[model samples]
Target: MKRPPYLKTSIGIGVLFIILMFLQSWLEKQPEALTASSEPETQTEATAVQPSERLVEDKRVYEGHNGTNLEHVYITIFDQSAVPENDITFYDLNESYKQYSNLDSGPKLDILFQTGTAKGPSDNGFISFGTDKPNATIELRGRSSRLEAQKSYKIRLQDNGGLWYGQSVINLNKHADDRTRVRNMLAFDYFRRIPDLISLRTNFVQLHVKDLTDPSSEGKFKSYGLYTHVEQLNEEALAARGLNPDGHLYKAENFEFYRYPDQLNHQNDPNYDKKKFEQVLKINGNENHDELLQMLDDINDLSKPFDEVFDTYFQEDNYLTWLAVNILFGNYDTMSTNYYLYSPLNSKKWYFIPWDFDKALGRDAERTDGLPQWQQGIQRYWGTVLHRRYLRDPENAAALTAKIEELSAIITEKTTKELIDSYYPVVKQLALQEPDLSYLGIEASEFDPAYRKLEQVTSRYKEQYMKSLEVPMPIFLHYERKNGRDVFTWEASHDLQNDKLSYEFQLSKTPGFESLIMQIKEQPDFTYNMAALPAGRYYWRVLVHDDKGHEQIPFDYYRDNAGIVYWGVQQIVVPGGSSS
Candidate 1:
C-alpha cells in the first residue's frame, strides 16, 4: 500500500541498518576462517610475522577442536601382518632399547596416524578418511619411561607427511611415573602464558592402537589409554615457534655446563668423540657447536668475571624465568638434564627451554619416591656448576628471587587449581579404565588427595625457595679412620647472612634415621670423633644451624638402585679387618 513519503523514507533507513549489522557480525567471526585442508597452509607458509603472532598460531594448533578437559584422540595403526613372530616389533624394540644412549639407533616400526575426538572407550569417533597411508615411523622415546609396559613413543612423519597439529615429530608420553598424568601438560600450559619463555605445544592425547601382528586376534582397536603429546623440539619446531631454524639446539643429557675439552671438541679435532660429546649435550639442531663450547669454556674459567660471562652468553630474562619457574615448581630433576638450550645463529645469547616436566609439581614428594632431602629450593640447583657460580653472586641471587616473585603472581593457587579441576576429571575417568588403570603409579583412591596436594604446592615451594636463600649452602662431608677411631669432618657452612652457625653430627644405622646410634648437638666445629665400628655398614650426616635457627643438611646423599635417595647421609662400610 502506498504511504506518505516521510514514512517510506524512515522504513528504508531502518532496513539498511539491519543489513549492515549482519555484515559486521559475519566479518568479525571470519578474521581467519580455516577449513581442515586450509589449516596446514597457514602453518606451512612462512611469513614476516612477529614472535607473538607465531606463538598464538602455535597455541591454537595444539589446543585442537576442544580446548577444555575433553582432549583429542590420536589413533595409530601398525600393520605387522608380514613380519615373522620372532622379528622385532614395536613392543620388542622398546624393550630391547630402554637406554637413552641406544634409543636413537633403535629400529622404528611403520605406522598409520589419524586424529579423532576423545569421546569414551566405546566411542573414539575416529575419522574414516584419516591419513590414507602409513605416514609415520614410531619408535620408543624417553629414558626411564621406556622401561614401562606402556612406553612413550616418538612418531616421525615420513614421505607421505601429514602434519598432525602442524608437527612432523609427535612425542606421545605415557607419563608412566606421573600418577596425575597431567603435571607435564599443566607446566606447559602455564609456561606458554609467561612472557620471554618459549613453551612447547602440549596436548592430552587419548591413544587407540590396532596391532595386526597377531592374526588370530580381532582387527578392533584397543584402548592404549591416555597420553600427553609433548611437541618434539627440532628444526621444524624452532621454525614453527618463530625461532631461527639454523640456531643451536641441544638436549642436556648429563650436561652440567662444564667444559669437556676432550669430549666436546670440534668435529675435526683428534679427541672429538660424538658419542661422548652427546653424553653431555645431545646436538638437536645445527651440527656446529663452536659457540656452545666457548660458553662452556667461559663458565669453567673461574678467572673470568661470572657476571660478564653470564651476560654475554645468556639472555637474562629467559635464564631467570626458566630458573624461577623450575624453582617454584620444585623440579629438582633439572639440576643437570631435562632441558633444552637454544641460541639464534647470529645472537650469542643462549636461552633455556624447559623439557620433561612430568617430574615437576611436587610429583616426587607426592609419590614419596625418596628424593634427597636437600633437593629443595636453591639447594636443588647446587649440583650444577653454572647455577652454583651464578647464584654465588648476591645480586644475581636477589634477581632470581625477584623473578620468582613476579612469576608467582601469574602462577598462583587460583590458576593452578583451575587447571587441576579441569584436568583431574578427564584423567581420572580414563585412569580408572583398562590400560591406564593397570599402570597407575599411585593408588586409585589417592588421585583426589594427590591433586589436592598439588593445588597449593607452588606457594609452598615459593616459601622454600625464599628460605633456601637465607640458609647456608650444603657442606661437603669427609670421613676417615684415624688411630682406631672414626673421624668425621665437613667443610664449614657459609651463611649468606653471615650469621653464627652451629653443627650437628649424626650417625644412623639406617638412612632414614629411624634410630640414631650417635648424635652431637650445638657443636662449634665441623669435626667429630667416635670409636671405630666393627665390620658393618653405617650412615653418617652433618647438619648446620644458623643464628636465626635455620637448619640446612649437607649435600652428600645415599642413592640406592631402587630409586630411593637419602640426602645429607654418607654410607660408610667398615671392612672385615677394620678396628672396633
Candidate 2:
C-alpha cells in the first residue's frame, strides 16, 4: 500500500514549484511599492542642487544735440536668482566720454529704498545714478537679487544738475487719422509724393511712448509732441558717404519743430552785402568789422545755394524753405550744432532739414502783434543758453530780423488771429474724434494757453530783431593742419576788411596751456615747426583779434572754437622709406 519513494519525492518537488510561481505573481503586483521607495531619493538630489547665477553688463554712448553725448546701455543675465559678486562693466557711449583706459565712467547715481520684496521698500536693490567719472562714485549696500526678473534697466544722463539739459520724453496723441490709416497714408505718400524721404511709423501704444520717455509719465510735456515736417540729417550716414561728415548736410529729421532755432539760418557773415553791413555799422560804429565779415562768409559758404559751391556745399531751396517755415513757427533752437546740412549718397548736392521741433509755437509767452497763437507757444519751452549763443550771431540775427519783418507784413494781426481760431476748431474736432487723450488733460480749450504764449515769445523775437539791426556782424576764424602745416582759415567772406590778411598761432594740446594758447596778442598767420610736435593729438586755435587785442564775443562762435584743432599722430611708413 505504501507508494514508491520516487512518487513521494515527485509530489514534494511539485509543491515547491507551485510555491515559487505564487511568489513570482505577488512580486509582479507590487510595482507601486518599488516606485514609492525611489521617489524621495530623486527629489533629494534635485533639492540639494542650486543654479548658477551670472550677469553681463554693457555700456555705450548716445549722441544728442550740439555734440551733447549720452551713454546707451544694456545688460545680460545668465541666472534667475543668483547675485553677481563683481561690479558690472560699462562701455563709453561715445569716444569723447571715454577715460584714459577707454572705459565709460558709469552712472554715478545712487538709489535709496527700504529693503523688501514688496513694491514700496527702500534698499530693495542696489540703485545707481550719475556719471561714472572720478570722485563721483555713489554706492549702497544692497543685494542685486531685488531686480525684477527678465527686465532691463536704463539710465538717462545730463551734464549739469538736471538744470542744464537732459533727456525728455514726448507723447504724441494719435493723429486725426487712425493708426492703420495713418501708416498706410504715410507709406503711400512717402513713395508717391516724397520718394527721397526716410520715414518711420510710430504708434500711440503705451509701450512705444514709455521707451522714448523714460522715468514714466511724470516727465515734462515739453519732451513729447507732434511735429510732422521735422527734418534731420544722419551724421553717420553722411560720414559713410565720404561727404561732409561734420553733420552740416541736410537731414529729414531736422524738420522736427524742436530742433530748428527760432532765428534765421544765415547770420554773422563777413561777406554779407556791403550795403547791409554799412547800415548796421552806422548804427553800431564800434562793432568789430573784421570779425563780422568773417562770420558772414562762413555762414554764406555753409548756407549758400548748393549749386554755387564746388560740388560740396550744394543744397536745395525747397528743403531750406521747409526749414524757414519751421523757423517762422518760432522753433528757434536749430543752428550749426543741432541742425545739419546734408548731401545724399552718390549725389553732389546738399540740403537743409529741420530737427527737434518741440519748442515751436512760442508756448510760454503772450500773443502779440497778431502772431498765430501756435507760433507764439514756443516761448514756454526755451532751449539751453548755449543754443541762443550760437544762433544769434550777427548774420543770423540780422537775417532773422529781416525775415520777421517780412513775415509780419504777410502774417498780419487779423490773419494770425484767424489762423489761431481755425486751429482751435480743427484741434477740437480731432479731440472729439479721439477720446483716449482726454484722460491726459488734453482738450481743445487748452490750446489757447499754448497759443498765447507763442505770440508773446514771437513779439520778443521781433524786439530782438530790431536790436540786432543796430549791431555790426561778428567775425571768426578756424585753422587746421593740412599737408603737415597749419593753414589759417577764416569763414568765407566777400568783405575785404574781414579777410585774414594775416594771423597768429598758439599751440598747446594739453588743457594746461589753454590760457597761453588763447593769449596770442596779434599776427595774421603763424607756423610752427612740425618737428617740434610730439606724437599725439594737438589742439590750436587762431585769435583774429583784429588790429586791437579784441576778438568777437566767444559765445558767438562757441561751436567753431574751443576744441582740438590739430593732430600729431605717429608718422606712417610707406614703401621705399617714403612716409605719408
TM-score of each: 0.79, 0.29
Candidate with best lDDT: 1
C-alpha RMSD of candidate 2: 33.1
Q: Give lDDT tens digits, candidate 1, residues 1-580.
A: 1112112247776676566667656855784532212232244424312221212224443444332344554444455544222255555666666444568777777666666555433222223334434656778888878777888888887655557666788898998878778888889888777866777777777787766554544756677888888888888777765456787889999887788776799877888888888888889988887888888889999999887888788767778889999988888789889999987676677888889888888776766656654577887776678988887766677778888989988999999988878787678888888888888866789878876887888998898787787887787899999999999999877666778888988888789999999888877777888888877888999888888988888888888668687878898988974333
Local distance difference test, each candidate: 0.74, 0.29
Candidate 2, 346-390: lDDT as tens digits:
333444433333334442232222332212221211122222332
Q: Give the distance in Å from residue 374's predicted Cα in candidate 2 to where it truly belongs.
A: 24
Q: Residue 91 of model 1: what lDDT?
A: 54
Best by TM-score: 1
Give me the runs in candidate 1 sitting further than 4 Å from their true place.
1-86, 97-101, 117-133, 442-445, 478-492, 502-538, 560-564, 574-580
Compared with the true structure, the alpha-carbon lDDT of candidate 2 equals 0.29
